[model samples]
Structures are given as structure tokens and as C-alpha cells.
Target: MQKIRAVVFDAYGTLFDVYSVTARAEQLFPGKGEALALLWRERQIDYTRIRSMAAPDGAYYKPFWALTVDALRYAAERLQLLLDPALEAQLLKEYACLSAFPENLGALKRLRAAGLPLGILSNGNPQMLDISVKSAGMHGLFDHVLSVDAVRMYKTAPEAYALGPKAFGVPAGEILFVSSNGWDACGATWYGYTTFWINRAGHPAERLDVSPSGTGHDMNDLLEFVRTQGAAV
Candidate 1:
């Protein structure tokens, strides 16, 4: 494989704990926070995929923030919970400030010290990415915070993956694409980037024919992978 020249990350689950909204969720719904969070996330991703597959030409594109709201509503209905406008607004507000993984800031700093250009390529819309990163106190760590809104397509779409190479001015083979989502890793791999999957939950890998170049449990493992790839970290 080519020497890893830059590292690009998937933001939502990989850097920010999307489930961190559970605290506010539980406060709002009383007893269904965990269930609500899980279902909301699942539906958020499902909506992205459905939109992308339904219109590969960008005709059906919607901002991730909108999809997230729709997912929350769907999840609430599925769980028989009452999500009125105020509760719905509260959850979305919480989501805008999702917490970062405990180890992420340190690991990212180490990689930055190693002189690798780091970036984020997320399905999130630009405003959502900006707010979340700033709220998490990771305001300036990355060289780019890319959003799929540019191409009106989400992850698993080659256009979305292309942003990393374009922004970093590197070939796909020379960039390490990191994502917590197995399907995203597979998509990046298929798009020719060296990929790493952060399997924090120890979930099974996707059944897709492709696989990530490396798999680990956290940002620390991701740092190790970069070190092993001969980066100065």
C-alpha cells in the first residue's frame, strides 16, 4: 500500500458520541432514552442510504440535520412515545452538541503532532458539523471538515468519499479513511482509500465483500494503526 499521507475521519459516530444525547433524551422521555437514541440513530442512517440509493443523481438529497429530525419522529412513533414539538426541539438541540469520545481529543492531538493533515468527512450538513465540532471543543484540530451536502449524497457514495482526496491533494491510496461505521469503511475501501474501522461497540463487520485495511476499538487503536503504517506518530 502507498504510504499514508493524510487521515480523514467520519464525524458523527467516530468522533462524537451520537448516543450522548441519551441524557437529555431520558430527561425528556423519562424511561425510553436508550431505546429512543438507538432507534433514532438507526433510522438516521437508514434515511441517508434510502435517499442516496433512491436518487444517485442528487435529486432526492436532504440535509443530514433534516433526516435526523425525521428519524427522531419515526423513532418516537415506533416506541409509542410522545414527541411534541418542544421535546423534539430539545433533542435536536442536544444532538447539536454531542460529546466527543474520551480518548479522541488526545489521539487527534498526537496525530497532529506527528504532522499528518487530519480532516473530517461526514454525512452531516455543514452547519451541523460546524456546531458539533465547536461544541465538542475540537474547533481547530482538522484541516477540513467536509460535508456530503456538497455533492448532495451521503456515505457509501463514491462522490462523498472523493472529498477527502480532493481536499488533501492526495491519492485515495495515500489517505487513511477512518469511520466507526463498518459500511462506511467498506465504502472507502471500495473507493480505493486505505481504511480503518473503529469498532467501539465490537459489532460484527458488515457482510459486504470489501473490508477495512485495519480495525480497532478506539482512537488509541487508530493512532497505533497510523504508527504501524510508518507515520511518525
Candidate 2:
């Protein structure tokens, strides 16, 4: 196991349970929420890439919410689902209050008490991350939340990967970059940190040129990885 000092985590899929929001969407939207949600998150990521690449002169300010709307619109079309004013409003409102995973808060609390520096390196804007953290009641749990918005790029971009260590003022190798997204993990690992892949979906790693240092089924296993590094846990 690598001796990780400051653990830098990827938000969304890593620690935040996005599915909780989608499932609720199903309940609230009465049959269109889940499909809308699947489309929403996918476009959320896709738009980041679009904005980053079309960096048409320091103008990549496609906020996460905008991307959500844009993606939801497109995803609805692709999935052949209808989106009305009421559905759109509900999705956005619910997203603002998405909760943390069942074990996320406890795991983070335990990790912090165990003496690890916890932080969120997310693709979300600072405001968005703040909302989710507070909704999950994890406002003060993280030492800091580093968003790619600060760098004007998404996590897959080189500039995005540099945000965490830059904010933490630590070496890349000292951070444990955890993510459920393969490409995100590849980006973090490629940047030199030890990565822990929260493979909660049982999916394979991205068919890329690199692999993360470790893969676990859930957050508990991630903590175990941290314990092996040094903490008694």
C-alpha cells in the first residue's frame, strides 16, 4: 500500500451517491425522472469536455447547472422522452439537494478522525459542491473542495488534474485520488498520486494506457486502503 498523506477525492461518483438523486427523480417525476437523470448526469460530463475543448478564448464558463439543462434536453431527445416545464424545474431543484451515500459521511468522518486530510476534487463548480456537501451534512468534513471551475477545465484535462495538489500545497504522490470514473482516475493517477478506484458498479477500468493503484467495491474498502497506508483505522 502507498503511504498517502493527504487524500484528494473526486466528488460525484466517488463519495456522492448520484443514484439517490436519480431514484428520487423516478418517484417525483412519476416515470420520467430516472430516464431524465441518466441523461442529465451523462450530459453533465459530456458538456464539460465540450466546453473545455471549445475553449474559445477564456470562455469555458459552462456551469454545471447549464450543462445539466443542456444535457437533460438532449438526453430526453435521445431517449425519446418528453420534457415539460414542470419536469425540468423539478430535476434542477432536486439536484440542488442531492444526498451523500449511505456510508460516505461516516467513512469521511472516520478517515478524518484517523488523521487524514480529506478534500474533494470535483468537476462541479464550488457553489454546486458546497450545496451537495451541506445537503449531505458534510460541510466542514472536507478540509477543502477544489473544483476544476477554478482552473477553467474539467477533471480529464491536465489543468484540472493539477488543481488538488495546487490547492493543498502538497506533492501529487502524497494524495490518494479516489474516483468511480475510470477516465477521471486515469487522469489523477497519471498526474502522479496514488489512486483508489471505488469500483462500486463492478465495471472494468477504462481501456486506457494507465490503471489506478487500487480498486475497491465500496467506501469501506477505500478506508481500509488508507489504514494500510498508516492509520490504525
Candidate 3:
């Protein structure tokens, strides 16, 4: 196996947690934080799927913030939260400063110090992704922050897979694509990446047409793999 030059990460869920937004929502909306948050996230991803399958080439990629607001609105209305525009903005802003797992920083530091390039291939809009990387204290850690907004499709889509080579200037084979979703790991794996699935949920693998390079319970196991980044031929 060839050495991996750049490691790319999916921002939300993989690196940053969206639950922080809902945790804050507990103050603004009563009794519906968890359910509202779950619904909001589910609907946000649903919106992306609907938009993607609609003509697939319609130059109609909505930004992450728009989806965030729309999903929030949909969830709020259904749950009867009635969040004002001001409160909504506050929640979105709150999302920008989410903290990451302590292991993320230490582990990434080891990778960088080992001279491997690091980048982000997230589904967030560029601005939102930027805030997330920075707030998580990872601004200087990544060589690039690539978002799906440019391609008008979300991750697990072919368009998102294409961004890896475009942003990193390397062929897919040399890029280690790390994501939390099994389908995403498989997507990039089939797309030719040396993939790693961060199976944080312990969820069983979804039936997929492609196989992944590895699957681990968390980033630390990923670090164990990284320690041998250049060891394999």
C-alpha cells in the first residue's frame, strides 16, 4: 500500500457535534431540545437529498446555513418551539464554536508533526466549515477546508467524492478519507480512497457495494493507523 499524503475529514459529526446547538436550544424552547435537534438534523440532510435528486445538475445547491435554518424552522413548527429569528441566529452562531474530542487535537498534532498533510472535506458551507475548524482549534491543522456547497451535492454523492482530488491536488488513492458514515466511507473507498470509517455509534455496517480499508470505534484507532502512515509500501 502506498503512503497517504493528505487526510481529509468530514466536519459535522466526525469532528464537530451538532448537539451543542440543541443543548443551547433548551433555554429558548421548552421541553423539546433532543427531539427538535434530532428532527432538525434529519430534515436538514433530507433537504439535501431532495435537492440533490432534483435534476442533479440544477445549480441549486443551498448553503449550510440555509439548510440549518430551514430544518430548524421545520422542526420548531412541528414541535411548537416558536423560535424568533434572533434566537435562531443565536443558535447558528453557537454552532460555530463547538468543542471537539480532546483526542482530536492531540492526535492530529501527531499526524502534522509527522509531516502528513491534513484537510477537511465536509458537507458544511465554506463559512460554516471555516468556523467549525477554527473553533475546534484546528485552523492551522488542516491544509484545506473543502465544502460540498461548491459542487451542489452532499457527501455520499459522487460530486463530493470528486472534491478530494480537486482540493488536495492528489489522486484519490493517496488520500485517506475519514468519515463517520458507513456509506460515505464506502463511497470514497469505491471512489479509490484509502478510507477509514469512524464508527462512533458502534452501528453495524450498512450493506454497501464497496469495502473500506478499515473501520474503528473512534479517532484513536485512526491514530494507531497513522502511526504507521508511511510504514506500508
RMSD to true structure for each model, in Å: 1.1, 1.9, 2.1
Worst 10 residues of 1 by lDDT: 18-27
Model 3 lDDT on a 0 to 1 scale: 0.82
lDDT of 1 by residue, 39-60 (tens): 9989999999999999989899
Cα lDDT listed for each candidate: 0.93, 0.81, 0.82
Rank list by lDDT: 1, 3, 2
For each predicted model, how many residue pairs clash, with residues at least 3 apart or on different chains?
0, 0, 1
Q: What residue pairs clash in candidate 3, if any at all?
A: 1-233
Name the 10 consecutive residues with the lowest summed lDDT in model 2.
Answer: 56-65
Task: Please provide, for model 3 over 1-233, each residue's C-alpha lDDT reduced to its tens digit, 9 standing for 90 to 100.
Answer: 87888889877888886667878887677687778788888898888878877757846678777888888889989987778889888877877788886678887887788777888887788888877888888878888888888887886688888898888889989889998878788888988899999988899887886777888988888987765666221
lDDT of 1 at 173: 95
Please provide, for model 2 over 75-105, each residue's C-alpha lDDT reduced to its tens digit, 9 standing for 90 to 100.
Answer: 7778776668897677676777777778888
Give the residue spans of candidate 2 off by over 4 A: 28-33, 56-58
Instruction: Name the runs in model 1 displaced over 4 angstroms.
Output: none
lDDT of 2: 0.81
Give the number of the best model, judged by TM-score.
Answer: 1
- For all predicted structures, in order, the TM-scores are 0.96, 0.91, 0.91
